[model samples]
Target: MDTHDLRLLANRIRRRDLQAVYEAGAGHIGGEMSVTDLLTALYFHTMKVDPAAPLDPNRDRLILSKGHTALALYVVLSEKGFLPKEEIATFLQHNSRLNGHPNRVKVPGVETNTGPLGHGLPVGVGMAKAAKLDGADWRTFVITGDGEMQEGSNWEAIMAAAHFGLDNLTLIIDHNRLQQGARLEDTNNLAPLPPKLAAFGWTVLEIDGHDMDQITAALSADNIASGKPTCIVAHTNKGHGISFMSDNVAWHHKVPNEAQYKQAMQELENAQ
Candidate 1:
């Protein structure tokens, strides 16, 4: 898709996410807003998957490790026909499969259940390893929060992936700089993250997470280094596309008031 078309589609998905969060009365809206563009670029522009056959073994895999951002993934999945778009209205409602965190078994396109931070990369490594063993060409992509990197398991997986030469794996960090209570720098800095990943023996790319063209370019398979895994540090805002919440730490899981909701909707609609 062209940049203009992808931008329009992203706006539509953002609006859907905004409405779902507003109606659900609770969600990880901050992270959802930050990562929407990355998810849009993947489902709409990068990954090769049939929404009609979400479990097709040969299809590329996506694991949302920061699963609190499942609302973003849900909207993207719906837009890509993996689920009924209307089902999005039920997000976080009682008994809804669309819960606060993605459940791989219940959700069509989700490859793993991950709300506990730092789990996605390891699972992605495993997925890539499986493909290697099976001689399959499918690739695995994962997105996690910068704050989530504080979890030690990610480092373990990094070592394993590098050791195994899992070049089919890609890890994108939503480096928004803010976490739930504080900025990543103040809490536990993972800054200079690209160099850290490189030292761990992975190929590193940095980009504006919300830019479709940049995201697409960085995600391209040709960019993967031979004999190494790929890691893309996607710098982003905690609450992107909405005025009051952008870069605001309090909005990490803050429910928007009615006025804020109306204003956010207007901002998103105006993008088109």
Candidate 2:
């Protein structure tokens, strides 16, 4: 898709995500807004998979390692035709398939169950390695929170992905600089993230996480430098697009009050 179309789709997804989060009475709306553009750029512009044939062996894969942001993924999947957009209203409801974290077994497009930090990259590495072992041309992409990087498991996965030469893997860090409790810098800082990934034998690309064109280009197959895994550090704003909440630590998981909800919904609609 062209940049204009991508932007429009992203805005629409953001609006839907906002509505879903509001109506469901709970969701990680802040992170969902932050990652909407990146997810839109991937599912609509970069990834190769038929919504009707979600499990097609040759299809490219996406793992939202920041699984609390599953609502964002669900909105994208709905837009991509994997599920009814209306289903999003059931988010976090008891027994609802649209849980706070994505479950691959229960959801069509989700590749794995993810919510805990530091788990996505390892699973993505396994998927990429499996593709290489099978001589398949498919690629695997994963997006994780910046704070999630503090998990030792991600480093372990990073070492394995590099050592195994799983060049088909692309890891995107949602470097929004804020975690639920505080700013990344105030918490366990993972700042100098690019240099760290580069030192691990990965090709590093930095881009505005909210820019569709840049996100598409960075995720394109040609962007992967051979013999190395690819890491795209996506600089983003937590609670992006919502005026009162953008980058506000309180919004991390804070439920929006009635007035705040209305304002947030209006802000999202205005973005369209």
Leading candidate by TM-score: 1
Tell me model 1's lDDT, rounded to 2 decimals: 0.92
Instruction: Give per-model TM-scores.
Output: 0.98, 0.98
RMSD of every candidate to native, in Å, equals 0.8, 1.0
Model 1 — TM-score against the truth? 0.98
List, residue by residue over 146-244, the lDDT tens digit for candidate 2: 989999999999999999988899999998999988899998988989999999999999999998878988988888777799999999999898888
Position 52, candidate 1: lDDT? 85
What residue runs in model 1 are displaced by over 4 Å at the alpha carbon?
Answer: none
Q: What is the C-alpha local distance difference test score of candidate 2?
A: 0.90
Positional deviation of 196 in candidate 1, in angstroms? 0.4
C-alpha RMSD in Å of predicted model 2 compared with the true structure: 1.0
Q: What is the lDDT of residue 142 in candidate 2?
A: 94
